[model samples]
Target: MTSDRITLLIVDDHPVVRDGLRGMFAAADGFEVLGEAADGVEAVRLTGELDPDVVLMDLRMPGGGGVAAIMELTRAGARAKVLVLTTYDTDSDTLPAIEAGATGYLLKDAPRDELFTAVRAAAEGRTVLSPAVASRLVSRVRAPGGAPGKEPLSAREREVLALVAKGTPNREIARELFISEATVKTHLTHLYAKLGVKDRAAAVATAYDRGILG
Candidate 1:
């Protein structure tokens, strides 16, 4: 937001990574490194305070993780676009972050130019993804049950999802349904796969969006 330069907030647990990103953005002409955070909690706090145009967030860190922070930020309607920057390109890492409301996903090994372009795209609220991540996502979409709200949920899965939509905790849901907590988790997982969502909130929202929860 400083005139034409894109403002950035670097979030990573490693000091070296943060330093490198700070230096990289600082040396670039069209970017300004607003601040750095060591974990997701700090990242959220600083995002509230600094109001950066884009956030370069890392996954899998102590204190807090990136997906949870993305969900929290999205829930709070943060202005900054979160562009996940991490070494993780696996489905478990990628889908959750995207579902949690990340604007883009990039591997840590991305080239300097690619990284800059991603940040710029994210700052403009465009979706960005590294080549590998994009390919994986495409493959996932081609897989069964990959489309959100398309696959029909089983009776038990529907029951679990309905309970989840009410914001009921897992234990309570299990008790109400006369099922074990593990069974509830299994049902949730199955429903999540069928719904093409990663967690409870997304499942409920997607179900409602698709008229499955109405």
Candidate 2:
């Protein structure tokens, strides 16, 4: 929780994965590895004790699962943001973690730069989703499952949201659509309001849940 460095708690059941992440963050600038957890139960305990700025969490573990840990952390009002770093990007995996209050979702194959960006965003209380995870959301939206009636999003907002789902930054999205950055932010805000979400990750998950991206 220092102002200068973003502290992290890496949570995974695999020793190799935890070791790699610890070394990676250690080699990176502006980040500090506070601790590591082998399972959700340990993750929760260390999270409460270390109070890391962000938790790089894995979904499946023997001792406890990530979704349950995230729910517990959210319920307890922990200050750490959970950024799910897993191998699975399926609907069942991504949707539940996002719904459980994860600040971001990223697959294990994510590039180092993308992972760093997502971690920084999560630390800043912003939501981030890897392109693959976002693509999965799009796929889910295209699937045949919709509840009765949900509020509609404007076409422009939908476009913005789609870009957000792909992990596009506001500037890049604006450039792609020939819009200003402020305009991109405005569209994001409107869409967030319509979707009842606070950030990009939640917005994408809600879009999938409501079948809005279709």
Candidate 3:
């Protein structure tokens, strides 16, 4: 394991989930839980105060929710990276979170090792996704005429889209492609317009319908 410990902040409403993540990360080497929050507002406050390197943020909190907190933090100029941790993987949540500047995403049910890897990858600015979600994103890019005369996305776009469908964030995408975050946004914007969609899930569906992501 690497000698450097990645500082992590857990932000989930459920006490059990927070406890579980805290236990899991605590037992693992190279990870330190900087703090925990039970709601979005608290999450925002903690982010400003603690400045953890990575935040495991949940999407649907009672007061503000993950997207709200993320937007607030970003607007406030907090540089901490946000990694979505939620039970729901719908595009509604994924797209908004991505647009709001989350750096990565992971399912609640992911295996322990994969979760650890994802957290580490997020801290290092690499996108992580469950395999099933990746396939869906790939499909959206492959759909024909999805972009209406726009050239099909390059192999890298397809790769990036696959990860996007799985809810991976730009930081992770940049690391995965060995490129800059600005480049990833450029591709995503171009892909969004081509696919005639506004967000990650729509892009994935369009690609699948066109038979590109497959």
Candidate 4:
């Protein structure tokens, strides 16, 4: 049977942020605040114990930043989807979290209703991005490259890479572009080989560094 409430584990460095999130979710319907963690280490530990449906993660923290925790959770095959709630939306911050398997990204200043919708979408394994972040990604992908000597990404490859850079998961990318997941993986493989990178993060970094993803 399907569950009615979405269970959440809120992870932020600030006690106030944690408290605020807890209080907000506690007052809402169709949601449950499972617990809170101050850093990535505790987030990972509690996630294992509590098994929340979604983790509202912060990007920057003193102990093992959010990216590291996201990577660890992906490696450990944790069941919870990570929805990043951070102050930073720069390419450096957004790309890593997405590559590390974050289900969605949202800014800390997002409206309460948007936050609620994002969490629910993430719990259903959908890709969510803040409007600013999405616009930034679109601009980056469409911007012309300064270095003309670099090998060019194919049109479709560029489309896939752009969505990937936007933190869109493979499933969503496939769905949006009307292709199969295997085709998306194939495009990623070719792009990775063309960019000479092993993973999504490296591919994005290389693209930016080479002015391919300006």
Leading candidate by TM-score: 2
> In candidate 3, what are the lDDT values of residues 1-214, reduced to their tens digit?
2348988899998999999999999999989999999999999999888888889999998877999998998899876788888887777777677668776767788889888878876776555555444444443344465434456788888888887755577888899889999999999988887767766655765666667756
Write model 2 residue lDDT over 77-119, tens digit each, in one string: 9999999999998888998898798988889998898899888
- Compared with the true structure, all predictions reach lDDT values of 0.83, 0.85, 0.78, 0.83
Error at 17, model 2, angstroms: 0.9
What tens digits encode model 1's per-residue C-alpha lDDT throughout 127-174? 676656654554334335445556688888888877765446788898
Ranking by lDDT: 2, 4, 1, 3
Clashes of each: 0, 0, 20, 0
C-alpha RMSD for every candidate: 14.1, 5.0, 6.1, 6.4
Q: What lDDT is obtained when candidate 1 is compared to the true structure?
A: 0.83
For model 1 the local lDDT of residue 74 reads 100
Better of 2 and 4 by TM-score: 2
Output the TM-score of candidate 1: 0.66
Models 1 onward score TM values of 0.66, 0.74, 0.67, 0.66
26-99 per-residue lDDT for model 4 (tens digits): 99999999899999999999999999999999989998799999999999999999999999999889878887
